[model samples]
Target: MTEQKLPAATRGPSDHTLRDQIVNAAMEYFSHYGFEKTTVSDLARSVGFSKAYIYKFFSSKQEIGEVICASCLTQITQRLNAALEEAPSATEKMQCLFQTLTVAGSELFFRERRLFDIAAAASRDRWSSAERYEAWLRETTVAILREGREAGEFERKTPLDETAAAVYLVLRPYADPVQLQAALDTAKEDASRLAALVLRSLAP
Candidate 1:
């Protein structure tokens, strides 16, 4: 018999009542102690809830981390969308994508190191939040490429999917939490240079 695949882990408790209280308290605790170091028990204690009560909403500490990770990444994507909105052309949007990602990643790494740890763990463990963020990035890149090609600003020789995938691969260092930390020193210069090269290659 073929083995059945397990359902994906549930992110849990999206309401704005008790669940929000638990998550808000957990975020503060995680931000101070870091995600890997924070436990469900510790979170419960910090929030004045029993461990069992906390478990009622979240199955594990990782679940809470996933919520926090998703929130953080959502902020980055929001900023990216805003930057893209102000750009006049697809070329500017592509460039804005790189610059915004690098700046946002660096800000998280330098100013919110504890939160960054959660993102790094999410990336390392292939968490749902990270997966979703990556998918959004790829889709956004593909949209930009398609727009450029249609406008006669970019060449149409390369298949859209392949080109978008290649672009994402080049962008991974600045986008991945762990890799971004290592690339931080050169991230600005690298993003600018890479965006220029990608733009040049895309020219019709």
Candidate 2:
């Protein structure tokens, strides 16, 4: 009987390190050439690795895009959290969340349009990263709603899950890359107005 060979990813200098190297190289390539135009072969050549080696780490180009998209979303979430922390009240936190997301999305759409495209694809395809980000945003909004109710700033009549889901839908335009790009010109103003409307609806 012949013995089977193990994949490079399984016998490497930390799968994490190898994965990071490929992702970093891909990011650089994607930044310059855009995601749709760059192929796995291009990435493999750019990283000085065989296409098979690349495959050993990622199943498809979309998987690589997922990693990059997740990183970008993580940064936006970090900014949102920081803004929330600085806010003195739940009302302010909610406002902060909307504004921060708007600004972050706008920055990515304009400044890093290539990456934005990748994120847009991820959202459209229902990638795990996109789903996770949406979940986190909803959970965070629920927390804010709970805090507002406890502080007598918001009404408690609506069910928490329902309210949170509604809030998430309202913020979807800013969080969804494709929608965000289309609304870039009025994103900030729209976020402010929408947040105000949400606050009014939540008032005790």
Candidate 3:
């Protein structure tokens, strides 16, 4: 028989509201103490629950971290999708994509320094949610590239996959927390220049 997988909320809480409270408390704990230093007991106390009670929803602290990671990526995906929808042209959409990444990533990174470390480690370890986010990012980028080709906004002879990969790499610094923090004061300027260069690469 195939095993049944429960929904995130159902796995932990009797209803959605309590699950949200747990998640919010976990986010606060992890942000302040960093995930490695936070204990199940600590989070449980923060939520006024017993360790056993918290376990009803989250199997472990790592699971809580994963949930936070998934939530962050979901927000980024929504913002990207909204930008894509609002942009009148593929070129503008591509521009909006990087800009959105810059703004969103910077805000998160600035809020908690260790958040970047968690995401980087998850990415290196090929965590499922992180990998899923990357796949979505790549597919979305490829869609924009293909749209640009169809609209005569881009004349690149490279395959769409290669083009998307190249574009993602070139703009990595704008969205990478480590790099962004290094030049935090100049981030906007750097991203604007990088965006211009990326657009030029796609020019016919």
Candidate 4:
């Protein structure tokens, strides 16, 4: 797909300008062509630069994909936080979290499938951002479990962190993008079942 060309630099372009240009172009390329199919030359051509020039801003094309994945994950984390905050209790917050994650995964994996590919790729490579994102998920899950126990919304048979980890493991297939892709056609059914199961597990 064609994009609006960036304006010519009167002097040499700033590093930030070049980096933004490359990133924007790379995002477009990754969205339209998928990450594996896209080439640095294509990104360079889109930004009216040479491949070498593009490499000056990013070490490799995979680096650009990692940057995009990081940005997306940050946004996802923000949304998850907001969803959790909107609920009145920890149980409700956990339910909201499930719905929010399911909807987000559907959007990312079904609507913007290529972006999902990038995230999956970064996850496989154990990129720092991906690791950080996973850590955030676990921490957030544990925090919710602790809040529930403190508020008498859930039982105290197990440690909050252990229970949270177990819950996440049970829910991963429903919440994780790569794992949920095959269930896209049954989105509503899967989401309902997963939410019900988690809510039941956390019930007092």
Candidate 5:
């Protein structure tokens, strides 16, 4: 008498292409309106479907929200991974990353802005995945520092783990309600400088 939990795609559209469209439309609705404010009706219209049609694809708002959050996380990680692979030096990789976060003349587009908005609003009881994401970013920066140390790019004796954490800590305020005012007041503020402080911690 146990109920079966269906997979995301198989629960509705088995075709991967159609499932992507459903999620993309939902992403737009969620971003244009806050998660709680977005209705299934609005989401359905975005996809040229009826409210009933959406229910065929997703069980509830939470279900779609979870999928949206996961999709965004996967996307940014993929982008960062690709950038990391192309970078011969960690400094350049880290620089490329920070550049993406705040610089307009980069691949990180306005589309990414919505993802960040939703990520900040998701209802995850455990922050492990989010923390892990931040940790991975820190570790990537640390790896870059290690490479620099060997190549005579850095000369200091600071602890690597601490420096890595600091890199994220500087950005943490942007997500926090209190310090986020700085970001809201001016998007042009230098996240790169903060990241540079972390990078320089390894220098002599």
Candidate 6:
């Protein structure tokens, strides 16, 4: 393992940066306290802003949740691409993805995890962006697999779309709040196994 630098948000104009501050505070409040238990006021207090000020930034708690998660999702995808650059082989690339996944919860994105938990489910209660995010993940994995195949690092026999879809389904649980929290140690260990399985199945 190496000393990994956490991804830092690039500073933009002050006007646009304030929204990220509000989202950051909401992520903290929601992740530390369950979503249902957290109130808009709690999010406001977390950011040292008044409840009225919170409304100026967000229309509702749900809006805050969406903004917070959307940012985390965008950031995670960016970092995953960065991780790929540091890995020489396809297997190593996939393995580094787990590190990226774990960091999503470790950063200012914890409340974003709670949002992910609800978003991962496909049931009626699933958040609106859940399906869209899942689709994005599937497409990303598919792209990686195709790239590996082109590089002659992954087997030509494996169906890229199918395997990518399976990868998302398999990894979805660990991306959740309860499963990720309860199984952190187990997941850390199993991440190696997961990496091995992906390599064995996909290796050229």
Span of ten consecutive residues with least summed lDDT in model 4: 1-10
Clashing pairs in 6: none
Clashes of each: 0, 0, 1, 0, 3, 0
Colliding residue pairs in candidate 3: 12-57
Q: Which of the two candidates, 2 or 4, achieves a greater lDDT against the reference?
A: 2
Q: Write the per-residue lDDT of candidate 4 for residues 132-155, one digit (tens) a residue.
A: 888888888888888889999898
Query: Best candidate per lDDT, number?
Result: 2
Off by over 4 Å in 2: 1-17
TM-score of each: 0.88, 0.88, 0.81, 0.86, 0.63, 0.66
**Full candidate order by lDDT, most accurate first:** 2, 1, 4, 3, 6, 5
Candidate 5 stretches with Cα past 4 Å from truth are: 1-25, 39-60, 104-116, 123-129, 171-189
Off by over 4 Å in 1: 1-15
Which has the higher TM-score value, candidate number 4 or candidate number 6?
4
Supply the global lDDT for candidate 2: 0.88
Task: Report the C-alpha lDDT of model 3 over 1-77, residue by residue, as the tens digit.
Answer: 12224476656545456667888897788778876788899989998989887777777777777877887778777
Give the Å error, residue 196, model 6.
0.5
Residue 122, model 5: lDDT of 48
Report the CA-based lDDT of candidate 3 relative to the real structure.
0.77
Superposing every Cα of model 3 onto the true structure, what RMSD results? 4.3
Candidate 4 residues lying further than 4 Å off, grouped into runs, are: 1-12
